[model samples]
Target: MDSLTADDFFALDLPRHAQLIDGTLIVPEPQGNFHSVSPYVLAQGLRRTAPGRLRVRRQMCVVIGARDVPEPDLVVVNASADGGPCLMSYAARDVLLAVEVVSPDSEERAQDTKPRKYAAAGIRHYWLVTMDENNRPAVHTYELDPHTGSYAPTGIHHDRLKLAVPFTIDIDLTEIDRL
Candidate 1:
């Protein structure tokens, strides 16, 4: 078996869905319909409420380091002074909020894998949206406590939440569940 270090993984330019953690390659499962819809609804809601102040993107790759680039489901970036997408590679500092909508098959991916990685990457805000068996969604927001290297709950919105940046808008969880 071949042992791949983070450096080696970073050097490969293959264009498939993959992430490097420590020194291992993680192949992400394909996102399904529900997974796609949640981000869409959230992004649209955010954009409508906070136009020009926040940039919301779906599945945008955030380059935390040469060996660590994870495509978060929804990333809310600070409004660029130039009023355009911050085309430069995204870092922990640029991210105002990161969101992951859990797919039924990938609960662990959201609940565990991403939280740890985002914390390590120094992302200040993170959210994991989990869906019930019936596909009803529940949203959990985590704010990274830099000193502790852990995420602390700022709030849990079962129905709606007004995010911290880009704009102050309420997101309806029922609309997310319908998506």
Candidate 2:
């Protein structure tokens, strides 16, 4: 971790996906087709609301703390005015929101640990997207709690995932399944 930087992480050519947290590498659990569906739907839906000002990036490495550079499933950031290439890395402050889609293999970290890290990094919003017992697209939105420096659950949605934070938008849960 002390020896690695955001640039180093990007330069590596790994055989599979990995994330760098606290100087260690983490490989995500194998996922099925359903795990990929929600991210695509949410990214597309958010893009419709963001229009020309915000950029929605999927699976980009984000530098949170000194050694925490995890690739969030999706991230929403302010678009660059120069209109050049997309950024290679984003500091925590530049991120408006980070979205993580949970799979069976990621239950522990996604639910129990990642939110704390995101909150500690001062990310204003975090959404934990998962499949519920009924297999519906479940989105749980968290906002940073300034006093405690932790995340507070602001909203949970199943059918119509709507929120005013980050931006006002309505995401159809069924669309996630259809996609």
TM-scores for every candidate against the unseen true structure:
0.77, 0.88
Worst 10 residues of 2 by lDDT: 80-89
Tens digits of per-residue lDDT for model 1, 97-150: 788887755567678877887888777788888765556556788888878998
**lDDT per model, in order?**
0.70, 0.80
TM-score of 2: 0.88
In model 1, how large is the Cα lDDT of residue 71? 69
Q: Candidate 1 has which clashing residue pairs, if any?
A: none
Q: Evaluated with lDDT, which candidate comes out highest? A: 2
